[model samples]
Target: MSILYLVKKNDELISHCKCEESLVGDPGQLDCPWCGCGWLFSCTKCRKAFTFAEAKEIDKTWEELAREDLLGYSGKEPELEDINSWIDCMQNMVSHIEAGKTYIYLDGCFIPADEENFEFEGWKSKHNFYKTPQVIALKDKDIIDEVLSNPQYWEENIIQEQ
Candidate 1:
């Protein structure tokens, strides 16, 4: 799996990049990909690059604090519950990344990602392309459920609804 690098300014996500490993390259050498104004620094915990100056004021790196916030590390092996919570948090983060994109429904319906004008016309409107809708009308629910539950199915069956 690839590591993700994120740069935040005032608690808002500004830039992000995917790296194969920790970007422990020379500090002050790389530029922030998102803003292009700040210099990149390696995060000690995740080894990812970020450009934040507040980290120095606190005598702690921003990446270290971010990891502590996300992972909840107490210098011990995390319990199963903690791991599960972290996983859920990461999933929510990924979902936020896709929050503003147009999504296609299972019934070949198009839904814009605008919250202000959004409307739930019917039950079919609740499901998006990333999440499979329950087809209770089908007689063979078991087979459909198994197929939909598989990640490979979503990867292979991405429809381009116009």
Candidate 2:
């Protein structure tokens, strides 16, 4: 079954976004292919965008999930000191975020946990099926506005009917 997100306001459900594995194409991918919401949800009722900050109000566990996904991390768990270094790197990248550049989540996974182990016979074949990390880029502001205004996006049949 797909993961279904419920958007609520005043304790009432207002809208939902279901992350279907088939539609998502990649299990490890962060964004919803159908809506491109990327963990953010736009309520069909009040039109409010549900963000990670808001998610914290509903469930505190979302804080960790947000950190790991947005800040990026290596495939294998890092040591305490390594974590501090990675945090510094991520912070620096955050300051330099800009338009037209692709930001990849989980990009560090390309490096195997143990390079030597990967050289063993059949190891590559065993792990080759892993889903690739996902990426998102901010285009020019005017171009973004133009795409947002496209009527076809909001058409009833743009995504397959559930």
Candidate 3:
């Protein structure tokens, strides 16, 4: 489902933007249609939009945490520290996306999480399918506008190679 939010300046609605709830949940950020500046995502603590620099830092932290979680120990059962680090990394990544500092592009059609079978069936056989991640240049204001105008463009243009 898509929701339109009015962009206001001086208490007047200048323009509006559409957000896909499935892609970005509530409290997620979307680029304003009138102005290129992003106004949707903000830090819960500071209420300020996340910068690219902050996103990079968080990404580095997440990588470090993931390394520690995966490679630091040689034990069968995961240690509390390992699990905690993984959780922290996930939280940081989510927060970074929520702040609109980074965007995730899935190179495939959307599949509802509730669906039981995600694989594709062909010739009496089932094949596992995974959505590939593509890096997008969110710095381009025009790209943002285009994406907002037509959310399906991404899926149509970029299809995952089987």
* lDDT (0 to 1) per candidate: 0.31, 0.26, 0.29
**Candidate 1 residue lDDT tens string, 1-162:** 233323222211211434332222212222211122112334334444332212111333433434454442245555666556645543333332232243222222222222232333221122223222222213344634344334444434443445
lDDT per residue (tens digit) for residues 84-156 in model 2: 5544543332343332222221211222211232311121111221221121112233422232223342242
Q: What is the lDDT of residue 132 in candidate 1?
A: 24
Q: Count the backbone clashes (under 3 Å) in each candidate.
A: 0, 0, 1
Candidates ranked, most accurate by lDDT first: 1, 3, 2
Clashing pairs in 1: none
Off by over 4 Å in 3: 1-41, 46-51, 55-140, 157-162
Model 2, position 61: C-alpha lDDT score: 31
lDDT of 1: 0.31
**Between candidates 2 and 3, which one is better according to lDDT?**
3
Cα lDDT tens digits for candidate 3, 1-162 = 221211111111112222211122112223221122222322222233221211222223433344433442332455667657555644543542322233321211122222333454322122343421111223344544454234454334332557
Instruction: Estimate TM-scores for all models.
Output: 0.24, 0.20, 0.23
